[model samples]
Target: MASYSGNIDYLAPNGVKMLKGIDNDNPERVYICTPLDVNEIKLERHPQDPNRMVAKMRVNICPLSENYKNVVRRSAQERGNANVSVPTHEMQMSFSVGYIKSVAQKFPKLVEQVKEANKERDPEIMGQDPTDENTHLFKAIRQRMNKRLAMLYQPQPPQQPSPYATPNVGVAGAATGYVAPAEGTDPLAGFTDADVGDLPF
Candidate 1:
């Protein structure tokens, strides 16, 4: 039986800290243990600090042979698996941190270089002459602003009244003043107790 192990630091809400330990007897069935419940998981930034955040997750364990067989069957059903063979243990474990430390260490430097190149490609503009009151671009922008102001001041037009503003005569014709009933009017009006009749036996 092969064995694997690793550790991961995960942030949690309400200033809670979570640390996970991964352990597996077979490469495909890794077990991840943490303090968080599998349900009610949430991902959010710390209330006091925006830069830090919590990421919720769930873990699963599966047999290596079963996992591989399922993958092959899925591919065959979906895209026609071409009878490709699975990788050896050594090849499968090549992604382990012990095997890829040097590559990982250079990631930060590569990110910094990329950021510097991006900055150079989109350099920021500074005011020309440092001491001059105004530059050519500034004067042109000011003149365009004045022309826009003059055009805005010259506008003159009145809008017509809407057709819907008039009251609907057809609907208004249906309504009439309510009339009070005369003194001897039947208290029950058109209804009779016979409508309710006798209860069924």
Candidate 2:
């Protein structure tokens, strides 16, 4: 399958029947790939197409043990083919445009989390603000604490545009992107004085 894609059932050739490999009847033909972490999942262009809008993916599989990798290298060296890469079975899968859109609309929470996790990192946050401490251990702790505080107060990705921006929508047009904090805003908006583990409050 040079091109990983699906064909309609009606488009199938005559006298051809698909088998349900999931059945116990054919263990040899069925292959199982481990469930990969959603965060690690990525999509890349299939080598066959450089300018297509298709959704072919080249998943990055987990690395095997160094011993196993060395075995591959040793075998290659014995065969005078050190540059060749190991081969793995790849499954080509495709879904309709409707199916793709449905998956996105179905997993709004997942989509939101993925977007937030991958948002651009702050360009200004290089490290903890340097201190005049002469001790290396103290300097390291201070830098870690500075980074933690910066991450805690970092602004979130922008939310969708809201119709409530108009003056009549709410209390005088509250702009979605840049609304002044309402009167009587919580003085401690980002802090919780509650006990949290061994945190030095």
Candidate 3:
């Protein structure tokens, strides 16, 4: 099993909220959302016990809702902005050896990616014992994990811009299907019952 040496305890200073009424069977409701950014992992002295070290990382994410996405798109269009970003918040979380092992089991491809990144960053990591905390390879693996997480969670925007604008496809064609939103109406007015999901980083 893959593992790290640092002690870690799960901590969410400003944790994501659990979906209110979905998945009643789950005591801990876990939802899927999009992560905007994940800061590089670092070892910090434990806040409660300075003598011990723990892994820490910052995650910025927004809850997933079809209506929320639509609102973002609509707002961007109103401002004539091409690039759009979802409303996001930052949260702090910790990683432990158990987390690494679980990731290695369920997400082996991630481990493989880390190995490749480690080799590119420091070829010596390929030969060093990964289990040893004193070795650079250990730190390299942690950094690689950060890289993989960022790639996996970052949101991907639309390739084409049709949804933002009704292209000039002749006057008759444009008028055929375009119905502009009200000047001062709630973008999410009709999506009050939309299912909101939490992004697990």
Candidate 4:
């Protein structure tokens, strides 16, 4: 007397149907199972569409008894083929933006520690004195702050009169026709290059 534990079902063109509770009166269409020695499982892709695909899976079914050996061998020969093995590796670390942000939030002391360490290493920033060894650092900080304030409260430059302000256009023409005395003439206007003669050469 043989014992079987696993269940089986029929996969048809219409749909899947259970075979366990069905009548076993027909010997020709009855489902049976013998102990099988499974070596490995194989998977393959469908022929039509590589992307929209199907798998061709196989499992080696070794026989426990001589009678079942032929059955298993026949099934194995019908289903089994050369299968490609897949390689997998263990995940070592998972670095994420959220994790980084969380770390920053959770360990602010660490951030402060790093900042303090950097300050210690740098020659130009000790406590808070402009004339100290860290004069350059203090100067840089002051300059940066000044730049920010200047950007915030910057004065607008004076706007120039538009070219179309006076519509009457003429070649070498002025808004007031008469040329006014050249305002504030240079005192050294009459001096020539030879006026300061006395070459050291």
For all candidates in order, the CA lDDT equals 0.30, 0.32, 0.42, 0.30
Query: Compared with the true structure, what per-residue lDDT tens digits does model 2 show for residues 1-201?
Result: 231222122112112222233435543342322211111122345578875433232322232465766786789999999674542222222222333333334333333333343334532222222222443322333222221111011133455865623221112122123223455543223423242221221
Backbone clashes in model 3, listed as residue pairs: none
What's the CA error at residue 17 for candidate 3, in Å?
Answer: 8.5
Candidate 4 residues 1-201, lDDT tens each? 432222122121111122332233442333322111110111234567665433222212222454544554566666773231111111111222332333334343433343354475664454444323235443333222111101011133445855633222222212232222354543223333342222100
TM-score of candidate 3 on Cα atoms, chains taken together: 0.28
Which residue pairs show backbone clashes in model 1?
none
Q: Model 1 segments beyond 4 Å from truth?
A: 1-39, 44-51, 66-80, 85-201
Instruction: Write the number of the candidate with greater TM-score, choosing between 1 and 3.
Output: 3
- Lowest summed lDDT over 10 consecutive residues: which window, candidate 3? 169-178
Sort by lDDT, best first: what order? 3, 2, 1, 4
TM-score for each candidate, following the candidate numbering: 0.16, 0.21, 0.28, 0.15
**Model 3 error, position 68 (Å):** 31
Per-residue lDDT of model 3, residues 1-201, tens digit only: 322122122222223232322344543444432121222244567889998777446543323466856887799989999776553322223344544444344443444455676677777766665555577765555444432222112345435744534222211111122233455543223322222222122
Off by over 4 Å in 3: 1-92, 98-109, 146-201
Q: Tens digit of lDDT per residue, candidate 1, span 7-126? A: 222221112322222223333332232222112233567789997767543333223465766675577767766653332211110122221222213233332332344444433212
Show where candidate 2 strays beyond 4 Å: 1-81, 86-92, 121-201
